[model samples]
Target: MTKDELKQRICESVDRRRSQIEGIGDQIMVNPELGFKEFETAKLVANTMEEFGFQTETGLARTGVKAVLKGKNPGPTVALIGELDSLGVADHPMVNPETGAAHACGHNAQIAGLMGAMMAIADTQAGEELAGNVVFLAVPAEEYVEVEFRRDLVKGGEITLLGGKCELIKQGHFDDIDVAMMIHTHSDSTMKKTGVSTSSNGFVSKLIRFVGRAAHSGGSPHLGINALNAAQIAINAMHAQRETFRDSDAIRVHPIITKGGDIVNVVPAEVTMETYVRGRTKEAILDANAKVDRALRAGAMAVGAKVEIETLPGYMPLANDATMVDMFEQNSEELFGEDELTKVGHRTGSTDMGDVSHLIPAIHPMMAGASGPGHSRDWHISDKEMGYLGPAKSLAMMAVDLLYGDAEGAKAVMENHDPLMSKEEYLAFQEGVFRTEVYDGETGTSEVES
Candidate 1:
């Protein structure tokens, strides 16, 4: 069959499984789980992939899952990825009361669309006419959260990196994959139905703690050193550095105090905080991160308290492959028209996909299917057709266009693309970013963690 004919058959197959596809998306929406611990979600994804006759692997990077569909001939390998974790949005309507995990960012749709593509590709037997393999990856922990728990896991040697994709890459899960692609749900009403940015911001995380002497709140309060006061001052200092940040760098620093005190009647002796210093480039992120560290130390110095800061490598700046972006746009236009193909130049948010983009040609685009700001309680899937079925047919068709016959499309992408870093360099840089230090306010001394 011709390439176009194969694509048409794939789309038809996706349409035939519309109910099942939508059900998968809806079912996940209610059963949301957090990153690196998505056992329930992994089970569901693995079972679905196995039923479709794909060779599946589970328990990767804690809770990641993957499956491969090989073509009649051997050539380049393409990865279709989906995040299998949710964020904490306690007030969301679909939140899990037991865990406070909610699908507020529309990750549920990513997996749903991924499954739809898998179903269509397999049902149509498109691999028979192709010259490459399709790898379906359900990765965990795209959202860099639960810092304390993840840090403990790292210290325990249960995992090395905090982000799921970073850990997967460290474990060489993507070694065989030639290219990768994933779609995120867009909540901005101003954006078109779909879009792809040329690039996006990267970030590094800081886990902070302020130590002070405790005292009875209603008694001799003068005997207490207020740790909360130090935390507040540090937040203000971080804000003060914002004006110094270059607009071209697109710097963003947002910190939240995770703990205040033990009891309302007692003066708090310890305060813990977490934040990410995000920017468009590695230099920019590091520059801003250093300034944040200085500000945290300033807080402790002023209060005569102690401060501990732990720095963790977050993600690399996303540089989407130009050729891959064009192919995705072309296939999306063919399937859903060009009206929703908005030209998104650069995004401020970050994702682990950026890490993969550094080592191979990768694309992380967006499709309009939800309303309300992402990660907010109001965020949810609004258009089932465009949200669920849109990516389904688009991904399947893109794969057909890339791997059909001699696989010229996939070949051109790899040939024209230049990776930002080798796998070894990427691993070394990420590992170097992990460190901890303590500053003693009274002694004006700092000690680095071994």
Candidate 2:
């Protein structure tokens, strides 16, 4: 069959399983789970893959699930990925009452689309005509929430990295795959039907604590130091550094005080804050991070308190593969017309797919089937057909285009692509970001540091 004919067959197959795909998506939306703890979602994905006659594996990078579909000939491998995690949005209508977890970012749609692609490719027997393999990945913990919990997981050697894709890379999961793609749902109405950004930001996660002497607020107040004042100073200092950031770098630093004080009657002795320093490039992110550290130290020095800062590796900056983008764009345009497609520039948000893009050819595109702001309580899948089926057809069609007839499209992508870093280099860079420092303001020196 011709490439177009194969695409038609795949789309028809996806339509045939539309109800099942939507059911899975709705189930995940209502039963949201947090990062690294998506056991229920993982089970659903595994069962679905198994039912479709694919070899499935679970417990990857904690709660990740992988399914493989072998092609007719041994060639390059392609991956269709979906994130299986939700954010802590207690106010969302579909949020879990106990855990406060909600799929406000449309991850449920990603899983649904992934399953739809799998059904289409497998049921239509499209793999029999392709020269490369296809992999369906349901990864966990893309939101980077519950920092302390994830830090403990890292300390206990349960996970090497916070992001699921990064840990999977460390575990050698993507070593076999040569190309990858994933569709994220967007809330932008101006974007029409579909969109793809050229790049996005990377970040470093930080946890800060300020320590001071506590005493009775009504008596002996002079002997006490207020850590909340130090935190306020630190936040102000961080704001002061904003003017120095280069416009092209797209630096963003937003911090929130998690713990302000213990009691109202006593002078607060402990204050904690959490934030992410995001930038367009790794160097930019590091530069902004250093400024933040200096500001934090300044606050401690001013208040005569000690400060502990812990920095963790977050997602890398995404650079979509040009060749892969071209292939996917072609499929999208064919499916939804040229006017429905839009090309986006740099986006300040980040994703774990950036880590995968650094090593292999990848594309993280957006499909508009949702309404309202992303990660907000109002966000939801507004158009079921566009939300679930659009991505399904786009991913499957791109796979056929790349893997058909001796895999010329895939080879062209590999030939033109140059990785920013090798897998070893990437791991070393991320591991190096892990650091802890305790600076004593009174002594004007580092103490009890790690």
**Which one is best on lDDT?**
2
lDDT of 2 by residue, 306-401 (tens): 999999999899999989888877888888887787898999999999999999999999998899899899999999888988888888898898
What lDDT tens digits, residue by residue, belong to model 1 across residues 172-226? 9999999899888888878888889999999999999999989998888899888
Q: Which lDDT value does model 2 have at 398? A: 86
Cα lDDT, all candidates:
0.91, 0.93
TM-score per prediction, in order, is 0.98, 0.99
Question: Which 10-residue window in model 2 sums to the lowest lDDT?
Answer: 441-450
Off by over 4 Å in 2: 448-450
User: Residue 58 in model 2: shift from native, Å?
Assistant: 0.5
Residue pairs in collision within model 1: none
